[model samples]
Target: MIHLFLGGARSGKSSLAEALCHRWPGQVVYVATARSHPSMAERIELHRRRRPQSWHCVEEPLALARLLAEAGEDQLLLIDCLTLWLTNQMMAGACLDQATEGLIGALSACRAEVVLVSTEVGQGLIPDDPMSRAFVVAAGELHQGIARVADRVSFCQAGHPIPVKGERP
Candidate 1:
């Protein structure tokens, strides 16, 4: 099964995703896409503190498709947030369309249950900067593509999840 959680920053989407992973019967792999940086240290630490040590964690800023393809059927893969992965791709000047396609293909082929968390960044005012605008567009497109393939989709608001597609867990 594939589940997707979407919301604005700090909307508790990650917390919800973690909760779902906790309920999985098999091993849970926490695939963290965010790169460590001084600005995000506190946020990263907060997430680290919340996750159980028993959950195997992999920090992959890129090559997510490769990782997904290697996952075993006995595992549940929880990708913390896709937006940061998108940012990493953008920063590396990677082709957005190709990367997105690879990820979707991996999702389709993956035997393991997967849960993805992503921030909804396109609802606000247009960005004044070109890169920021591009990021927003890319994120929005990625979210839509995932939503189309996701078996379950939920939108988070003020720490509450609202089911958007399929049955809630």
Candidate 2:
């Protein structure tokens, strides 16, 4: 099963995704895309501490499709956030279309239950900067693409999840 969870920053999307991972009767693989930069290193550590120790962590800033392909069938894969992954790809000069296609293909072919968490960045005013605007557009498009293919989709607000597709949690 593929589930897409969307929320704004600090909206408890990651916690919701982690909780859903417990539903799967298999090992959990947490794919973290956030890089530990000097400014956000403490935030990263706090997130790491919140996750369960039993869940295996895979730090992939890019090449999401390859990592998905490598996961075991008896494992549940949870991607913490797609925004960071997209940012990494953009910074690395990756072909956006190819990367998006590759990720969608991999998600379709993977046997393991997959849960994706992403920020809902398009619900605000447009950015004045070109790069920021481009990122917001790309992230919004990516979020839509994933939601279309996912079996379930949800949105979180104030730590409360409201089902947008499929049954309520």
Top candidate by TM-score: 1
TM-scores for the candidates: 0.98, 0.95
- lDDT tens digits, residue span 1-169, model 2: 8999999999988888888887777799999998879987887888789888888899888988998888778889999889999999999999877788889999988888899999999999999999999889888888878888899998999887889988766
Candidate 1: residue 138 lDDT (0-100) = 87
Off by over 4 Å in 2: none
Please report the TM-score between candidate 1 and the true structure.
0.98
**lDDT for predicted candidate 2 compared with the true structure:** 0.88
Q: Find the 10 residues in a row with the least total lDDT in model 1.
A: 17-26
lDDT of 2 at 62: 94
lDDT of 1 by residue, 6-85 (tens): 99999999999999888887899999999999998999999999999889999999999999899999999999889999
The residue-level lDDT of candidate 1 at 153 comes to 96
